[model samples]
Target: MKRYGSIIGVKPEKLEEYKKLHVAVWPEVLAKIKECNIRNYSIYYKDGMLYSYYEYIGDNYEKDMQKMAADPTTQEWWKLTDPCQQPVENRAPGEWWAAMEEVFHMD
Candidate 1:
């Protein structure tokens, strides 16, 4: 398993709306994530910033991600979620959510 972390900003005005939508994510979207081999997925919000963590269990991360991207339900889900976000200014190239380096880990 590979652990990943990333960060993005939530537009202040859209914070409440974003939080509301997450209360009941569509079942199809959830299934797509599992089908792509992402597990232990979670998103956290704090001070206008959103952080995400997930473990990738697939042999090919990029391939699995592409598979997820090709799903129509996932695309529609992003259409709803993307508007509420602002990518971090210092994010690395090609990063929508800034990839975070793990400096420490316990078990």
Candidate 2:
């Protein structure tokens, strides 16, 4: 499995709405994530930033991501959550959340 981490800024005014949405994530969205070979997925909030961490078990990361992106359910989910997030400065082209480098790891 490969570990992935990313960060995006959350709108302070919409923090509550964002938290509420996560409290009961849609079942279809969760299934789509697992379907794409993403495991141990979690999103954390701190100081207006949302940090996401997940493990990818798929052989083709790009292809799996593309699959996820193409899902209609996932697209609908993004329509709601995307508004509450702001892409971090310096993110790579086409990145909604800035990818984070793993400087060190254990286990």
Candidate 3:
């Protein structure tokens, strides 16, 4: 499995709303994520910065991501969550969340 981490900025005021939405994530979206080979996913927030971590167990990462993005349920979920997030200034073009560099690891 490959581990990935990403960072995004959450508007301070919308933190509560974002937490509320995640407290009961949609079943379909969760299913789709698992179907796409995503596991052990978690999001953390601190000082307006949100960090997302997940492990990809599939061979085709791009394809799986595309499939997930195409799902209507995931699309709807994004509509609600996207607005609450902002890409960090250093994020590359076409990236909503700044990809984080892995500095240390143990397994």
Error of model 3, residue 65, in angstroms: 0.5
What is the Å distance of residue 4 in model 2 from its true position?
0.2
| Cα RMSDs, all models | 0.6, 0.6, 0.6
Which residue segments of model 1 deviate by more than 4 Å? none
Q: What Cα-based lDDT does every candidate model obtain?
A: 0.96, 0.95, 0.95
TM-scores for all candidates: the values are: 0.97, 0.97, 0.97
lDDT by residue (85-105, candidate 2, tens digit) is 989989999999999998988
Model 3 worst lDDT run, 10 consecutive residues: 86-95
Backbone clash total, candidate 2? 0
Worst 10 residues of 1 by lDDT: 98-107
The true-versus-predicted C-alpha distance at residue 45 of model 1, in Å, is 0.7
* Tens digit per residue, CA lDDT, model 1, 81-103: 99999999999988899999988
Per-residue alpha-carbon lDDT of model 3 for 35-99, expressed as tens digits? 99999999999999999999999999999999999999999999999999988998989999899
